[model samples]
Target: MQNLQAKGLSALVAISILFAGTGCQSNSASATPPESSKTLDTAPATAAPAELPIISERAPTPMGEESVRGAPADPSAGTALAQLETIAIKGRAPKTGYDRDVFGQGWKDLDRNGCDARNDILNRDLTNTVHKPGTHRCVVASGVLADPFTATTIHFVRGNATSTAVQIDHVVPLSDAWQKGAQQLVPEQREAFGNDPLNLLATDGPTNGAKSDGDAATWLPPNKSFRCEYVAIQTAVKAKYGLWMTQAEHDAIQRILTSSCPDQPVPTDEGGVAVPIAAEPAPVPETVQDTPTAPVPGPVSGPDVVYKNCTAVRSAGVAPIRVGDPGWDTKFDRDGDGVGCE
Candidate 1:
C-alpha cells in the first residue's frame, strides 16, 4: 500500500512538471512581438532635398526645370487687348528697309545718351554694377544677372574682360515692334522705344540672337517653367508699346498664361508696365509638341520645310530665302553636323 502511494506521489509531481513546462512555452511565444511589428521597426528613413540650381555665364543649362505648382487666373487682359487695337503699331513692317544704322531718328545722340542704354539697364537690374575706372558710368562690375534669354544667370566682369556673353535685349524685339506699328511713332516715342530702360535688359547673347525678331505668335522660351511669366511680360510690353497681335498670337499668349498660372495675377502696366494676360478667343495648355513654325513650303510637298543653312536659319524672313532656291538648307543643322532632316 505504501509503495502504491509513493507511485501516486511520483505521478502527481510529473504532472505538475509537465504543466509548468507547457506554461513556459506559451509565455515564450506571447513575449515575441508580432511579425508585422518587427517589419515596421526595421524599415529605412526618407531622403533629403537636392542642391541649389547652378548659375552659368553664357552656356546652356545642364540643370533642368523643376515642376512648379500652378497659380490662379490673371485679370489684366480684357481692357488691354481692346486697347491694343486702338493703339496701332507705330513702325512700318518693311518689304525693304534700312539696317540698324538707318533710323534717321531722335535723341540725336550717337553714344545713345553719353551712356549707352545697356549700361543704364545693367545699373537698374544688377544689385551693384561696378562702374568704369575712369568714366564712373560704364558698367565694370555687373554681377551675375538672370539672363532671360536662356533662363540662366550670366555674371559680367568689369574693365578688362568684357563679355559679349551679355547683351542688351530689346524687350520688344526691334523687328517685332516695327511690324506691330512702331514706324508710326513720333521721333520722341521712337526714341523711347529704342532706349526705355523698362524695355531693355542685360541678357545672354546667343539666346538674345535666338529671340531675334520673334513675337508671341512665332516663338517662346525653351525653359517650360518660365513661359507663363514670359508671355505675361511680353503682353505687358506690347501693350505698353501699343503693339497689335495677330489673332493666333493673341490666342497663344493668353492660353499659356491662363493654363500654367491660372493663379498668378496677370502682370500689369501698373507699378510701371506689368505684362497683362490677354483675355482672348480661348486658351490652350502648353505642350512639348513642335510649335507650328511659320509656314514653310515643302518642295511644296514633302516632310522638308524651312530652307536651312546658317544665315537662312538665323535670319528667318528677313533676307533672301525665296522658295525654289538651292541655298535652302532645312536640316536645322544648328551645329552643322552633316546629317540633314534633324
Candidate 2:
C-alpha cells in the first residue's frame, strides 16, 4: 500500500508540468504589439500642381494721351460702337486713280513739330530710342519696337534694307480711305488724312504686307490679344476722316469692338496733345477805297492785307512761298533770299 501511493504522487507531478508548458507556449504565440508606434517612412500620394501662364516682360503701358477719341467714354465700347455705327455702309470704291502722290508729298511735318511724321511715330512707339546723329531727335537711329501687329520684340536699325522691316502702316490704308470718302476731300484734307498719326503705325514689315489695304474684315493682328486695340484704332481713323465701311467690314469691326472692347476709347490726336484748329483770318474784305493817281503803295498796309508768322504760314498752307506770292511776307524769310516763307 505504501509503494502504490508514491507512484501516484509522481504521475500527478508530471501532469502539472505538462499543463504549465502548454500555457507558456500559447501566451508567447498570441501576444499583440501596442497601437502607438511610428513605423511610416513617407506621406501618402497626391495630385500635381497646375502650370502658370506666359507673360511678356516688355509689355506696353496703356497710354492715355494716345487716346484718339478725346475724353474717354463712360463705357468705351458703347462710344466706339456708336462712332462705328455712324459710318455709312457702302461698297468699296474703284482704285482707279489712287496715286500715292494724291495725298501730297509723303511725311510732311503737318503738325509743324520739326520732325516728319515717320520719325514722330517712331519716337512715340519705340523704347530706348537713339536719335540719328545731327538729326536733333528728328530721325530714329536704333530702338526697340514692341510690335502690335505680331506681338514680337523687334530691334529697329534704320537702313534701306532693315528699314523696310519696320514699315509705317496706315491703320486705315490710303487706298481704303480713298474708296471710302477721301476722294471728296480737298488736297489739304487729303494730306492731313495721309500723315495723321492716328491713321499710321510703325509695324512689322511682313505683317503689314500681309494686311495691305485690308479693312478689319479681311485681316486682324496675328497677335490675338492685340486685335481689340487694332480694331479700335481703325474705327477711330474712319470716324476722324469721315470714311465709310463695307457690310463685311462693319460686321467684322462690330464683332471685335462691341463684343471684345466695347469700352475701348478712341485714340485722341495720334500720339501728341490735341491742337485746336486755328480760325482763319477774316477774309480780307473787298476794298472800294480809291487808289491814288500816283503810286500810293508803301509796304502795302490795309484791311485787305493778310501777313502772318512763319508757323501760321506753314500750318495753313504749304512751305517755301516766294517773295511776291499771294501770302508771302519778308518777315518770315530766315535766309533773306528772293523766297520769303521757305
Candidate achieving the largest lDDT: 2
How well does candidate 2 score on lDDT at residue 161? 40
Per-residue lDDT tens digits for candidate 1, residues 126-193, read 54355655754543454667665576867776431245456666666765665555555544455556
Model 1's lDDT to the true fold? Answer: 0.51
Q: Each prediction's Cα RMSD?
A: 14.1, 17.0
Put down candidate 2 lDDT per residue, 74-127, tens digits, no spaces.
Answer: 453456667788888877665546655577654777777677777777777777
The residue-level lDDT of candidate 1 at 317 comes to 40
Error of 2 at 238 (Å): 1.1
Q: Rate the local accuracy (lDDT) of all candidates.
A: 0.51, 0.66
Q: Which ten residues in a row have the lowest lDDT in candidate 1?
A: 60-69
Best candidate per TM-score, number?
Answer: 2
